[model samples]
Each structure stands twice: as structure tokens, then as C-alpha cells.
Target: MNKKLQFLVLGVVLILAILFFSVKWAFRPASKSVEKEKADFTMEASALAGEFEIDEQKANVMYLDKVIQVKGIIDNISDEKTVISVTLKDPESLSGVICSFDKSSLTITQLTPGEKITVKGICTGYLLDVVLSKCALVE
Candidate 1:
């Protein structure tokens, strides 16, 4: 083909190729298993909660979507049958670490409030409580 036509076709192809690869990478499934991923930070559950309460934006930058290992006393377990919500800190406290486990996880059934435990999960950020998902019992 003439140079102008060839150049136009090549540019369109390059743009299409870039878009295709970008979309593919963006939609790709995460390769790291939550259980196998290392914690980016480790701290007492109370401390983590406090950080979010004190400076949510800063805490979000540091912990949101990152794996964290937290140690605290179990405050409560939700009465829900199909989900596990493990609260860390005083049961009455609004600000606390709430680690959620999948219903299929057997470990949640074994947990009790007032027990000291260590858990690892991805920090999902704070609302009333600092929420963590995909939590696994560390101890």
C-alpha cells in the first residue's frame, strides 16, 4: 500500500493492541492467594482502628486493599448463620477492627468473644469499624 495508507493502518493497529492488553491486564484475576500473601503491616487491632479514626485518608493510603495482621481480643461474632463477623475490641465500641471470614471457613465456628487472637486479612477501610476481608486465624 502507499506510505500514508500503511501508516494509518499501523497507527490504528497499535492503538487497538494497547487497548486490548490494558483491558486484559485490568481484568486479570489476582494471582496471590489471600492466605498465602504476606501482611504489609502488623499491629494491635485497637491501634489499627485508632489510625483509621484519627486520619482516615492517611490510613487508607497505608492499609486499604493491603494485607494486615492484627492481634486483639474478640469482641463479638455476629449471630448470622451464613457469615462470620469477628469484632475486635470492646463489644460496645463503635470503632474497632471487624474481620470477616467466608462462611465456608471452619475457623470462624471455633472463635469466641473475649478470646485473644491474631488474624490476617485485607484491610477494606473504615466506616464505623475498620473492615477486613478474607481473614484467616493466625494463631
Candidate 2:
């Protein structure tokens, strides 16, 4: 092939490789999701944004994306479908973890504004809006 064609092919290959790796990496479930075997860890929302948070390193770990149990006061039940958002209370502020529920996972027949509840979901990410994985309401 001509020199130009050779460089063009190399560029194309490099671009494709980067794209493939990025998508795969981005969608790959966090380590906690696969290795945890059972997501049973529990945390209160207050600890997450306040004393529990570091914002330096403890943000995006498998524990955050793995299906784990958390007990917190029901601050807000945002959606009625596959996604329910629950925030911490009092000192933590609602900006703690904006977890998303897997609509098919669980059902809450009696979720109240100030009720304490247990939830299980993966910790997805910790941004301005922290998020958990495919969440499920614990009975």
C-alpha cells in the first residue's frame, strides 16, 4: 500500500481500538457487581456524604457499583417505575447518593416520606450526583 494509505489504516485501527475499549470499560459492571457474590454491606446515607465520604479516593469502588444493602430513612421516592431515588437525611443532605432502582427487582407497598428502609443495589458512581446500580428495595 502507499505510505498515505498505510498511515490512514493505522489511524483507523487506533481509533477503533480506543472506541471498543472505552465502551467495554464503561459498561463493564464494577468489580463489586461480579466478585461480591452477595451484596450485603449496609450504610446509612448520613455517613456517605458526611463523615463516610472522602471525595478523594473512596468514590468509585466496586462496593459502590456492587449490589449491597443500605439502611436509610426514606427521604424521597422519586420514580414509580424501575428507578427510585432515595437520599440521606438531616446532616447528610440529599446530595449523597441518588440511587436508581431496577423496577423489576422489588416493590415497596409502604414506602413513606420518613420511614427507614433497607435497599440493595450496586454503587455505580460518585459525581455531583452519586448513584448506585440496578437497585432493589429490601423488604
Candidate 3:
């Protein structure tokens, strides 16, 4: 084959390869639910918040991106359009562990403030509050 024709064919093959992988990645199946995954760490909600409050960098290394199960009294609950966030903390403390769930995944009608519950989620990080995402109530 001619050199020009060979180069054109190679370029088209590269483009097609890139497009194939892109589409495959874009349509990949969603990850398993947090409820189904095993927890990497489990502790009280106040203790988790205290860890972040004590030393954020150390806490991040130990907890960030890890699946955790935390038990505490519900301090607050908010139902946004697509997400439900439950704050767990001690009655006297200002900071808390904020656990977020997909609205469709949880039956929030059964949850209320001042109630004790266990939740499993992936710890994202800390601001004023320790944040957990993809959370589900643990029965």
C-alpha cells in the first residue's frame, strides 16, 4: 500500500480505538450500594467527628474514602430534592458526622431526630463536620 494510505488508515484506527474506550467507560455500570459493601471501620459518630476535630490530616489518612459504620443519635435530618442528609452527633456538641443518602434509596419517613441509629457510608472528608456519602441505615 502507498505510505499516505497507510498513515491515513493508522490515524483512523487510533481514533476509532479512542472512541470505543470512551463510550465503554461512559456507560460502565454503577458501583454496588454502600449497604452491600463491608465497612472498613466502625465506631460511634461522636468519636468519628472527634478524630477529624483532633487532627484533620491524620483523620483523613485513616478514614477518608473508607467505608465506615457509625452509631449515634440523630441530630438533624434534611430531605433535599434528590438527597437526604442525616446529621449524627452528641446533644451537647456542635460538630457532627453528616451522612448523605440517595432519596430513593432510603425511607426517611421512619428516621427522626434524637433517635439512635447506625449508618454505613464512605467518609468523604471534614469541613466543620465529618462528611459521609452514599450512606444507608444499618438495621
Which one is best on TM-score?
3
TM-score of each: 0.72, 0.57, 0.79
Candidate 2 stretches greater than 4 Å from native? 1-37, 51-53, 80-82, 91-94
Could you tell which candidate, 1 or 3, scores higher by lDDT? 3
Better of 1 and 3 by TM-score: 3
User: How high a TM-score does candidate 3 get?
Assistant: 0.79
For candidate 2, write residues 1-139 as lDDT tens digits: 6999999999999999999999999998743222224665667665654433556265445355456666777666676554556663544464565656555444445477777766666666666645666666664
Candidate closer to the true structure by TM-score (higher is better), 2 or 3: 3
Query: For model 3, which pairs clash?
Result: none
Per-residue lDDT of candidate 1, residues 11-111 (tens digit): 99999999999999999975422677899999999999988989999999999899999999998888566658889985544599988886765355688
Q: What is the C-alpha RMSD of each candidate to the true structure, in Å?
A: 5.2, 8.7, 4.9
Worst 10-residue stretch by lDDT in candidate 1? 29-38
State residue 110's C-alpha deviation in candidate 2, in Å.
Answer: 3.1
